[model samples]
Target: MSRNTESPVDVDEALTHIDSRGAKIRKEQLERTLSQLQADSELTADQRLAVERLSERLVDRLLAVPRASLQDAAQNADEETIETAMSLFE
Candidate 1:
């Protein structure tokens, strides 16, 4: 029998949520996390991309939950999400 290690076919994407009470705090935390991650030479491009995607996707949800920094939130995040949001938005 063959084994399928991936998520079920119905699961189109996986999401991670971050929480923060203040917009300024959330922005600072997200920026710090992104800058740190972007600077890391040890992480692969795909790994960074996935994290960025998850962070961008969860901005709203992140602001909803009880106060939590994306620094902590991103750490708790699953380390991967859906697509790319790294390209400069023109």
Candidate 2:
């Protein structure tokens, strides 16, 4: 019997692995990344403040809608909403 030895994976670099983990897992990854960025020692005071503001905005947006409704909107975005989004890019 032959044993196969493979190198350990860097989970963050594996796109397919990340995608397979679904929304909750991806949310966790986003939080971990944000925390890591916030803790970086080299950021200037202004840069840190900007990151803090962005983080607050992210929290606000996430809490603006209930999870079920957000999921529903994502799965069934109405034509009017789609058109409005398209117009923004035009």
Task: Give the winner by TM-score.
Answer: 2
Error of 1 at 44 (Å): 2.2
How displaced is residue 29 in candidate 2, in Å? 9.0
What are the per-model C-alpha RMSD values against the true structure?
Answer: 16.3, 15.8
Residue-level lDDT of model 2, residues 1-90, one tens digit each, is: 123264432322232232333344445755686678768756677875676566556654653343333334445633333333333323
Colliding residue pairs in candidate 2: none
Clashing pairs in 1: 18-62
For each candidate, give its TM-score against the true structure. 0.30, 0.31
How many pairs of residues collide in model 2?
0
Q: Against the unseen true structure, what C-alpha lDDT does each candidate score?
A: 0.42, 0.45
Quote the RMSD, in angstroms, for model 2.
15.8
Off by over 4 Å in 2: 1-41, 67-90
Error of 1 at 29 (Å): 2.8
